[model samples]
Target: MREAYHDQLDSIFDDLAGICRRVETAVSLATHALMNGDAAVAERVISGDVEIDVAREQVEETAFDLLTLQQPVATDLRTIVAALRMVSELERMGDLSVHVAKVARLRVPDVAVPDEIRPTIERMAAVAEDMVGRVCEVIISRDVEAAIALGRDDEEMDGLRRRSFAELLSDDWTHGVEAAVDVALLGRYYERIADHAVSIANRVIFVVTGHHPAALAEQ
Candidate 1:
């Protein structure tokens, strides 16, 4: 009975990991679309959302089945629960990427942005991608140290969002109201994507070490 339960636990995590991969693919496609204004790529990102959604549902079902079948205890229970919560976070991250692509499509039709902002956008996207990727790494390896650094990466995303927000709100923002709004929305989406990654990292911390990030800090 124990061996059977262990297999279920491993199987659930295998499906959860696939959810992370789908998010990374969508994010990369969306970032390219944002940077190069590729409608074809944007459409691909938008369409690929279907895969993320399907993976999310599969993860949830697997977790629930494990809970019903195994009634996991201790670390096993914690891991399954964390997977359930983290999968939702990952799914929302994919949606944020789609939002960025939509905003990118809007911007490309109107005018070209200055090169300075492009690099910043690219950096933000890169950090966001790393955050999602690292969380999956931590999950697969059960490495608490790897999860810990995700907070620092998230701070970088926060900084990028703040800088872009200030630029858009500044009096010198000559992009007009429509473009300015699009930029702000895209920045917010990236920021939130980072936030979701942070959430998953915390979940990994809890699952691997049995202590939440908040608990660790209080200690």
Candidate 2:
């Protein structure tokens, strides 16, 4: 029974890692759809979100069962609790990707990102993708250092979001109000995705050290 419980615990992390990979793919596909105005790809991402949602539910249920049945304590308890939070962050990341795809879908044949802002959006997408990928590694390995480093990536995302806004507000800006709104919202979605990845990383730190990242830094 002990071995079985451990196996179930391992399965929870495994499932979380798999969900991170899927969210990474969703971000990439959504970016492509946004850049190329590919409604089909956008629709693919939107439809596939249900799979992510279902996976999240399964992981959550398993974690809850383990908590209820095994009554994990100390590190094991922290791991289970952190898994719950991490899985939710991953689900939110998936939802953010879906939001990006929805914007692309709404635009249909017309690309949602204009030429001036495309570079910033592209960079945001790349950074968001990289963060999610690193998140998968951190989840599996529980590397506290790597998890903490994700904050730097989050910073870069914030800068890119600011750059996108600068472009929108520039004197030379010619895109209409609708396009501007899309650019602003798209930048926000990507930034929020990165934010969620960082949140999961922080959770990993807490699980391993029994302390939040902020408290560790103060030491």
Candidate 3:
């Protein structure tokens, strides 16, 4: 019975890792759609969000089941509890990706991001993708160092967002208000994706140390 309980914990961990991969893929595909003005890719990303949602529900249900039935303690309990919160962050990240894709789809046959700000959007997407990919590794390996280090990536993403806004407000800005609004929204999505990635990393820290990163930082 003890061995079986451990196996269940392992399964939950694996499923959480899988959810991260799904999020990574969604963000990647959504960004691709944005860059290329590909409505089909955007549509696929919008539809694919259902898979992320399902995976999130599975994680929550499995975690709660483990809590109710097995009486997980110590790190096991931390893992189960953190899994619930972690999946929530992951699901929100997935939703942000869908928003980006929808913007692309809305402007179908024409790129949502004007050329003047395309470079910033492209870089923002790249940073977000890299952070998600690294966070997946952190989750799988339980690498505290990697998880904590994700803050640096978040900082970079923040810088990119500021740059995007600066470009939008520059005197040379040629895109009208509608396009500006689209770019602003897109920047927020990318920034939020990075924010969620950092949130997951903080959860990973909790699973490892049993203390939230914010609390630790306070000390």
Candidate 4:
């Protein structure tokens, strides 16, 4: 019976990793749609989000069952609890991807990002993609070092966001206010996606170390 319970715990972690893979695909497709103004691909991303949501719910239900039926303690409890949090983060990342797709869809044939700001947006999307990919590895491997390295990626994302703002505020700006707003929102969406990746990494750290990264930093 104890072995079965441990199996359930492993299943929950596996499901979490699965969700991360889904989010990674969503981010990549969303970026593709944004870069090329591909409304069909953007629509694909928007509709596919439901699957991620459903997977999240399933993981939550399974984790809840483990928590209640098995009454896990120590590392087992931490792992189950962390799975819950990580699933939520993965869902939110999917939502952010949908938001990017929506922006792409809204602009139709016209790209939402202006050429001047396209490089920045592209870099942000690349960083966000890299982070999500790393997150999948972190969830599956529980590599604390890899998880911690995600913080550096998050920092790079923040810098890209600031760069986007700088472009909007530059004296040569001529994209008009509407394009400016779209660029700003896109930057924010990508930045938030990276932030969620870091959050998931920290949760993994907690599961392994039994302490939050912030607390660990204070030591």
Candidate 5:
């Protein structure tokens, strides 16, 4: 019985890792669609967001079932509880990617990003995608050190956002108000995705150590 119960907990962990992979793919696809203003690709990303939502719901159901049926204690209980929180963050990351794709669709034939800040936007997207991939590794391996490293990746994302905003508000800015808005919103979307990755990493640390990484960082 103990072996079977442990296997169930491992299954939940595996499912969470799968959820992370799906969100990572979503962000990459959304970035490609945004760069090219491909309405078709954007539409696909928007519709595909439902898969992430469905996966999150399944993870929640399984975690809750474990809590009720097995009464997991200590690390096992933390694992289930942390899975709930991590999946919520992963779902939000998918939603942010959908928002980016929506901007691509809304702009239609023209790309949402202007030529002036294209590099900055691309940097943000790259940083965000990289962080999500790393977070997936951290979760799957239960690597506390890699989990802590997400903070640095998130900082790089923040820097990219700052550069994007500076360009938007610069005296030479000539992309027009609508383009500026799209750029601003896209930057926020990318930044938020990285933020959520960091949050998941923190949760992974919590599951392993029984203490949130955020508190440890402060000490």
Candidate 6:
């Protein structure tokens, strides 16, 4: 019975990994949809959110089952708890991708993305992508060191998020208020995504190493 339960735990882990990959694709599509102004791609990202939602529910079910069936202890207990927490973050990331797609759909014509903030938004997208990628890697390999490294990378994302907001409110962006609003919203989304990614990493560290990583001063 213990052997059967262990197999069940492993299977749930695999399912969680698939959830990560799907979300990564959703985010990438959302980024391209934003950059190209492709209505089809924006629609695709929005539809993809349904899949993320399904995955989130499935994961929650599996985690709850494992807790009751296996009655996991110590590290094993942490594994189920961590998986549950990570799924919440992953689902939110998917929702943010959908939000970006919605914003893209709204800004198809007038109010082109201003010249000043495009690069910053692009950087934020890249950071969001990288954070999701690294978090998945940390989960797949159970590498605490890699998770720590990703946490550091999140700092750069925070810096970019902050600059994007500052530029939006400053006189530097006088021409496009609507575009400024989009940039501000998109920046906040990416920043939140990055935060969730870092949380997943920290949870993994706790699962494997039995402790949380150092808290970065949240600005």
The local distance difference test score of model 4 is 0.91
- Better by TM-score, candidate 5 or 1: 5
Q: Residue-wise lDDT of candidate 2 within 65-167, one digit each (tens)? A: 9999999999999899889988888999999999999999999899989888888899999999999999999999999889989987787887888888889
Tens digits of lDDT, candidate 4, 1-219 = 999998888888899999999999999999999999999999999999999999999999999999899888999988888888889889999999999999999998999888988889999999999999999999999999999999988878888999999999899899899999989998989988988888888889999888899833522
What are the models' TM-scores? 0.91, 0.96, 0.96, 0.97, 0.96, 0.93
lDDT of 5 by residue, 1-219 (tens): 889988888888899889999999999999999999898889988999999999999999998988999998888988888889889989999999999999999988999898989999998999999999999898889998998888877778878888998999999899899999999999989988988888888888888888877634632
Ordered from best to worst TM-score, the candidate numbers read 4, 5, 2, 3, 6, 1
Native RMSD of candidate 1 (Å): 2.5
Candidate 2, residue 40: the lDDT equals 96
Quote the positional error of residue 103 for candidate 3 in Å. 0.4
Candidate 2 worst ten-residue window by lDDT: 210-219
Q: Kindly provide the TM-score of model 1 when superposed on the true structure, using C-alpha atoms.
A: 0.91
In the order shown, the candidates' Cα RMSDs to the true structure are 2.5, 2.1, 1.9, 1.9, 1.7, 1.8
Query: Which should have the higher TM-score, number 3 or number 4?
Result: 4
Indicate the residue-level lDDT of 153 in model 3.
80
lDDT value for model 3: 0.89
Candidate 3 lDDT by residue in tens digits, 35-67: 899999999999999999998888888888889
Task: Supply the TM-score for candidate 3.
Answer: 0.96
Error of 4 at 155 (Å): 1.2
Checking candidate 3 for backbone clashes, the offending pairs are: none
Candidate 1: segments with Cα more than 4 A from true spot: 108-114, 215-219
Per-residue lDDT, model 3, residue 75, is 83
Model 1, span 71-119: residue lDDT tens:
7788888888888888888889989988987776766743334455667
Better of 1 and 3 by lDDT: 3
Off by over 4 Å in 2: 215-219
